[model samples]
Target: MSSQLLPRLAQEDESTDALSGPQTVTRQARPLRFITCGSVDDGKSTLIGRLLWDTKAVKEDQAATLRRDSTGQHNELGLPDFARLLDGLQAEREQGITIDVAYRYFATDRRSFIVADTPGHVQYTRNMATGASTADLAVLLVDARAGILEQTRRHATIAALMGIRQFVLAVNKIDLAHYDEAGFQAIAREFREIALSLGVRQITAIPVSALKGENIVLRGDDVMPWYSGPTLVETLEKATQRTGQSTGFRLPVQRVSRPGEGFRGYQGTVAGGSIKPGDSVVVLPSGVEANVKAIVTYDLVRNAAVSGDAITLVLDRPVDISRGDMIAAIDQRPQTGRAFTARLVALSPDGIVPGKRYWLKAGSRRQRVMVRPVSALDLATGNWDDAAVLALNGIGVVELDFEEDAIFDAYETNRETGAFILIDPDTLNTVAGGMIDSRRSRSGRFDALPDADRASITLPARLIEAFLKTEFARAHVGEIRVTRGEKE
Candidate 1:
């Protein structure tokens, strides 16, 4: 991709009277974006369909389509694609499953929502990861009878690992479990421990049967009398906690719009904190700073916009900028690096291991890289050890070397630009999605050590840190070589 074709930011402040136009400002709170994730056959689709149906989010025509598709021939089971109300894919209906993230927009009196119903099978783990990465909250579903399964823990762990703070454990199929209080409590207990261990801060456990509509939209008289919490709908409706923002402002110009009169517009979503007209901003990957002259949207060139608004920014100087480049406050700059090391889960059918080259897509940025799975920590022991390959449902850490500078924040910091997915070149299949924790040495000093030698080595922290730093610096300066270094 040519650097010139990327988006650019402008600098000026002459549009104070631009708001005098006809369009009225309907300023409202930004919608929250979230995702639903769980294993297959866990009633994920039913829960969402119920939510839309109960909330009247779906139109009559769409509901008719759902009904027609759900009526199978000869009264056989009709597996309609409930999620297709958003994306309407033929393959989704035929497979009766979600292959990709299907986004749906809905609003209540309280707040607006952009919900991504992600796939929930072992094979589509990457899709689930992608969905959960950007979500402020995760709605994790599970069968009441089949409580705390491996895949259940896996999904919960992924949600926590992705830095999602709020979790709603929708314990579906409670009717099948006879709405047993003991059963529900047992599952909730186990989930609470796992969630806490995985760093999940807030968890709300609800016992409801998605199929029977018990405790979903309304209270069920037949459900356990001891449980007195609000229904799923009510709980969600009452949730008013908004997500926090970055202390600094950063907006990556996705595209530039020129609306004539020699006015160049920088169009993109505000990815970081609030930005105002007088705020001094820097165009990154170029290291140029310019004061913000105007923030325009439709007929208004306003003073500021909170994060999540897709507004056009007009700066004080027309410097060279592009799509992959980021715009941020002059004093608060994001960290930059060419080589990165991250934890990745194998979403490929063949699994992820050493010498696997693929294309990585992070937000609007794409890069070619290779995933070398060095170690897999035993979940039971919490000890890292070498693995031949990380198969489906396996979690491991890998070293990634990008062909270009892939700008990103740590997953702990920002989920928007920090998460990415690997795509197979041959099939163009999204194989794995990952969150960058902390960058390791691209030289793979620790990864290259033999399994036997790694266990025995216990070098000083300073020596190990210096050696690793120098090794990676050399690799970044010249040829990409990750050969094993000196021992002892």
Candidate 2:
């Protein structure tokens, strides 16, 4: 590969941009992060290696070592075993499978990329979730010979649940299938059905032979001219970043910095909407109100701060705020509750034990929680089946019982504040990764009254009986209503 290809890859077609209209202005070129995942021996490493090799991201010396290691294992094109580039672990090489997540960084002329090659075995589904949690897109590879396997659906389901909308189905090993276009289309159609059922709207399918370096970096027009679409590199450069949280300002206090006797600052990353000086914010759980005094950073005092920024916040008044408490917008605050419902992915060997106490960590807060599995997700059928316990690598819905008042937003509204991990108290290992679906209460009461006020409010017996008789109220009523009599 020549270094000259770099300039050629970076050059965009002027006509295409003009036809598409003006491009959105970006402050910086944030690398598009993605992950490659699917069943074992699906050519994930080979696809990534082909991408790096054709783009000249691999140095000559590294290629020389690959050639020496390959020995008699070179393909018909005389290329070295591309899988060797990513199988860094001795165990992985010996087993001929990816056992852990392998991350690789590479850049094209137009954009940079960070790709995580995740393991495909069912036992390592937790590793796949870890990579997909932060990815903007997921590239799922399927063997041309084996259309859609159980593990393929498992990866897709996990990726979609992690909030990845953009998907690329690379039908790898076209050469073994005689480069049959019909075979590729059949697999693409079946996968599209599964993707749509999972609520994924954006999908792109491509046919390629990773070992032969076809339709990966360079187009395989000579082999399959009938299939005309952007190459794998083009799909990545054009993909957009995940949208920011559309909720009100949120800052989960990581630490209380008290450098001086009279000065106290809350330090954390902005998890939601932007915040500015003088903004009225409320401390969660305690419900103490404070005004933003200053937005402090290492560089200087910033006028405003948006999501993804790590900074120190100074409140105007002395308030009872501490680590694990969330500082949110005064009017639009997140839900505070003692119980909630969430979807969890079991990550440990022992799996999730129902009615067991575990430490749940979300953002900077850690609290004791008891988990009760309600139902498990059927990946193949996209159905929820009754389950009493979640096994290893199993995904299920559960009820979370918190020992204290917990503050959180729906995972769909804010990924940062809604995501959490469960740790086993005895083993001290991560047992599950969970996302908050909604808050739940035994009494079905979610009013904003104080604990004392709630205890005092009582509903009339007649009103309760009448309300329960109504058809609409029977299934949906979750709150008690009471009104005082008016003076005549």
The model with the greatest lDDT is: 2
Across residues 1-488, which tens digit of lDDT does each residue of candidate 2 receive? 11111111221432121111223322225677899999999999989988989999889999999899899988888888888888899998778788889898898877888899999998888889999999988999999999899889989988887888778899999999999999998998898888888787677788989998888888999989888776788777666667647679999999999999988899999998888999999999999999999999978999999888899999999888889999999988998999999999999988888777799999999999878888998877778999988988888998888889989999888889889999998888999999999998745332322233333345666876786697656665555444555641
Model 2 misses residue 104 by how many Å? Answer: 1.6
lDDT of 1 by residue, 410-470 (tens): 7676666667888888889877778786665555443553333323445576765675577
Sliding window of 10 residues with minimal summed lDDT for model 2? 1-10
Index of the highest-TM-score prediction: 2
> Each model's TM-score?
0.73, 0.85
Let me know the TM-score candidate 2 reaches against the reference structure.
Answer: 0.85
Question: How many Å off is the CA of 444 in candidate 2?
Answer: 8.6
Against the true structure, what is every candidate's RMSD?
11.5, 8.6
Clashing pairs in 2: none
